[model samples]
Target chain A: MDIDLILKAINITVIGYIIVFVVLFLLYLSFYYLAKLLESQAKERCRRAGKNKCAEHDKFSVDSDTTAAIAMALYLHFGETHDIDSTKLTMKRESKRYTPWNSKIYNVIHRL
Target chain B: MEGLYRFLEYTGFANFTFGHGIMIIVGLVFIFLAIKKDYEPLLLVPIGFGIILGNIPFIQNAGLNLGVYENGSVLRYLYFGVLSGVYPPLIFLGIGAMTDFSTLISNPKLMLLGAAAQLGIFATFLGSIFLGFNLNEAGAIGIIGGADGPTAIFLASKLANGSNGNLNLIGPIAIAAYSYMALVPVIQPPIMRLLTTKKERVIRMKPPRSVSKVEKIIFPVAGLLLTGFISPASLPLLGMLFFGNLLKESMVTERLAETARKPMIDIVTILLGLTVGASTQADIFLTKQSVLIFILGALSFMVATAGGILFAKFMNLFLSNENKINPLIGSAGVSAVPDSARVSQLEGLKYDKNNHLLMHAMAPNVAGVIGSAIAAGILMSFLL
Candidate 1:
């Protein structure tokens, strides 16, 4: 019950609280910077893909189901958005000239 | 009658004491928990068996030299493996191989949440120092905040050396950390619910896009360089972790990666568990301080989770409505890996079934492993 000891304990506790706040503040700033960087990168990738010219447009929309499934897998694997135009173009080119059911019509289709 | 008496005496039943009986019962319970409940069966089963074997009176013949006269015993050597900071890092390497870092790279911002979660480590460190532990002991005790078993053991072995040569503290610390990790589902939800309203919990994060393979390969290497430069003591654990990860991503060392992920890790876990549990003899484990350590471990975990969540809430003030993070994922920053992340996801799903926070949360979840290791390294350099 020494008054001096009690005061010392209070001082230590206050210091500890202050330190926690400081560390937490630093952590907040680090995350803010990281998130800002990620957002900018996402926008840049979208631009490179010829989707939205700027951040204020919706040039990269996909159907809901396809978006959900592909989004999850792509994010898990790549950590960034897929280039929408390239993927779609690849799919279209593959389907038209090489449809599986029309294998026998391939020569005629190629001529056409 | 004489033959029967002779057989009983030879088996040491005639000389059985209360301590021996208690240890046997404890071992039996450990066996039951392992076999029936499957509670960490790989290590628990061996440890249970080792405890029973070590406790058998006069098994002094079977390496039970208790050194009634000396301060140390044979069990001391077996326990030394855990105390030297060997097995746990090897176990970490295995974990690194098995883990999928794609979730983390896909959402790098979550790494901040992981770093925020380490607030518990520093808080507990100060608490322990105020409680009369020296710098080293405080460092060891604080890592319980990381919620990682190997790191706890590694730090404890480093701290609890010298004058307090009692390396036995590692066992309790590790067991407590791993136990709380398994209880994440139970311990985290209420805290998550209380801190975050239903609407906040259910907030949906926009899915991140695909990351390139080059990015994946670069992420761990860059992380190691950055964190290691800041805190070199973290090199042993973090370096090995990223190395194992690099092996997996590089895709050339399929055999080495496969080995690291399974049998190599399994073997180390068994050895590590038995060695750790064997150190918990009745004389050492049954103490007031031991109980305090367990309680403190739980407190550290709670504080770490709270710190992460609160930090996220603070961030919400600045972020646009769409960019504000779901604070539930903040809890995953304690280095328990996918368990803490899964807990965050579950809490998020409870509020919004359509909301998926697992992948996003995983970024912080994985970053926590590195953060805690850096914290440990800093402590090691300062204290040791």
Candidate 2:
């Protein structure tokens, strides 16, 4: 009930906010640029792989309509069934422990 | 006739008080809400049944001990998880295992929105004091702003305990916090809408950049150092959180992460929920102070949501049109995780279906967890 106590609470709010902001801001600066760098490198790797290999990697902005259309087309053609190991003309890059697909966690989050 | 009278005396029907009946109704209402409304049913179901178990009157400290308050009872052993502060950190461990930090790693700036929302905790701190709670009780009540049940329990366990070792306020505080969490669908959207305009709600944020595995792996380590350096008291909660993330990101520890996220979390949640429910016997729960704490708790959630939204709006002023954040995502900064973020998504969909804010909202939502944990740590340092 004391005015001083209120002031203390207010001060805690202000200072706490500032500290959290600064720490996260520091993370923002570091991680933002790091992500940018990693993205650029990924793009470069995609380019090196050839224009056809990762056409969608650089085009991350594909609209949901396009995605839905693609999905519908696939669904119609495949009739809701597909063989897991159907052979197709494709080349392999070296296997790695962590790709977006294989790490098996993206199933947990909606990327799009 | 004498034996029948003794049996009747031993039966709960003979000993039940009106308070016990009232608490039973409270427990039933919780169960009904869980089943009908599907409001945090995993939590409310166990807790609701536990409340019934708690309020079942029996002879104290006797061989037929069924009361939670009675010594040498099964419920007393379970309640030790709450008293000893074991279940929460383990829950955090599971939360860490299941949590995807990619949203946060993608948009680190959103972390500030999480921090900004902790205003609710301090705001409620003062509110509780003015409403006549002492310093310790005020701190316990204020943490309801975290919208996080475990942190609230941890803080209440430490702060609200009297010199005589009485933990009088933990029950109401936990219930209030979880109730607000379940009501995220109700409590957050209005504050979010009131604080932001339609245009702001409809604004689309760019999809977060795809994160790399190495970065994801390193994040928990760096985050641990940064937050731990700031608040050592938060280390137990934060440590388990980061440790679980490490197991998840390490990839070699997939089995461990799966175990932590699934079975470990489920077990801890069951114990934590049941004990918390049982702890809410009407004698401890129906106090005038409990009412005030609930009121302040609701207020804290509102202020936290508004603060996050306003902070997002404030940040938008500095951002270019292309980079502007939807202020609706700001309300997700209350650490209710997928629920508040889901609210943001639903509210955004109400404006423009194309404006999917789920991923963007998740950044601040998870950040809110860290922010609230940090706030809890800071408060513990001050009050305890």
Candidate 3:
């Protein structure tokens, strides 16, 4: 019931909220700029790769068989090691059962 | 006849009060909500059962030693984890292990929204002060605004009650915090709808840029140092949180991280929930102050949700059209984590089924945890 303590708490609230906001705002600024930098770097890499491909074509134009062989190699490498078309990953149940937890219980019963 | 009378008086039937009956009913209601309504079953089931066990009255300092208040009792040992503020940090460690901070790192501006949501904590502190709770008590009550049950319990354990059992507000404050956290789905969506337009809800944000592993690893360390310098009092909570994140992100400590998130969290939760429930003896719990704390807790959640949305809307004024935020994601800035984020996703889907806000909402959701811990540290610095 101390008035002084209550006044102190009010002070803490003001100072505290201000400090929290400033710290987070600074974090936001740093992160925002970091993301921007990353985005630009990614674009730079893509552009460089595009230019390098053009340079390769200009320097030594591969014949039809050579191009076919390179394409086949790429297709094989990608087919074995990569997810071609780079689709967005999803998380959901695509089951006929409308409710999963309930449906699974019935399935357990039937299985048994 | 005197011996028989004494034995009868010692029986649970003789010791049981009407308050205990009411508490049992309240506990049943919680259980029902957990089972039928599917409301935070992981938390509620243990807590509800503990409430039942706690209210089964016995003689004071009996040989059975079943009471949470009794010294050398098993439940008391578990309850000590709460009173000593041990379990929450451990819970934070588990939380950090499970959390993917890439979302927050990818869009750190949303971290500001999390900070903005903490306005509710301070607002409720003032309300609690006006309602005649002491500064310590008010601070504990205020943290419910963070919508983080463990932080609320941790802070309240340290602040609301003294080292000895004088003026215990931990029961009320912890319950209010967890109750409000569990009700995030019901409480947040209407406020979100009220604040934002359908057009705003349907707005799609650009996919967040993939964060590098190095950045993810650096985040926890840098975040700890930044927060530690600002609020050293929060180190116990933040240290564990960031440490757990490091364990997960480092990839080398996969076993330690896996155990911390799953088994470790589950075990601590059971102990923490049960102990917290048992602490709520009707006499200690059903006070005028307890009622005020619950009222303030609900108000705190509303204001915190509003604060985040308003801040996001304010930020939108300066933002380009493509850079603008969906105000629904603002509610996720409260520290209820995936639930609040899920609520945002549900709201977004209601407007546009193809709209998926979960990943975007997660940025603020995780940041809200950090924000609340920092707020707690701030309160500790001032009050403790």
TM-score of each: 0.74, 0.86, 0.85
Tens digits of per-residue lDDT, candidate 3, B1-384, equal 999998899888998888889888878988999999999999988888878778877787667777888888999898999999999999999999999998799778889889999989999999888888778888899999999999999999899765543368888888888888889999998899999987888887766656878778988988898899988999999999999999999999999999999999999999998888888887777778888889999999999999988888888899899888888899889989889999988998899876677788999999999999999999989887
For model 2, residues A1-112, the per-residue Cα lDDT tens digits are 5888777767776776677677667767878888888877887998899887578786666443454467569979898576676678788886444566555674444354
- Please, what are the lDDT tens digits per residue for candidate 1 over residues B129-244? 66665556667888899988788889988887435643446656765676677566777778887888877787776666555566667766776776666667888898889888
Tens digits of per-residue lDDT for model 3 on A36-101? 776577567767789875455334433324433675699998888855666798888865553676
Candidate 3: which docking quality band?
incorrect
lDDT of each residue in B1-384, candidate 2, tens digit only: 999988888877887888889989989998999999999998889888888878887655557867666678788899878877788899999999999999899778898899888888888987887887777788889999989999899888788854444447878998899888999999988788788887788898876766779899988998899889988888889999999999999999999999999999999999989988998777767778888888999999999999899999999999999889999989999998789999988999999976777788899999998988888888888777
Give candidate 3's TM-score: 0.85
Q: Show where candidate 1 strays beyond 4 Å.
A: A1-112, B1-78, B161-167
Residue A27 error for model 3, in Å?
Answer: 2.2
Best-matching candidate per lDDT: 3
Candidate with the larger TM-score of 1 and 2: 2
Could you give the interface RMSD of each candidate, to one decimal? 6.2, 2.6, 10.7
The residue pairs found clashing in candidate 3 are none
Error of 1 at B322 (Å): 1.6
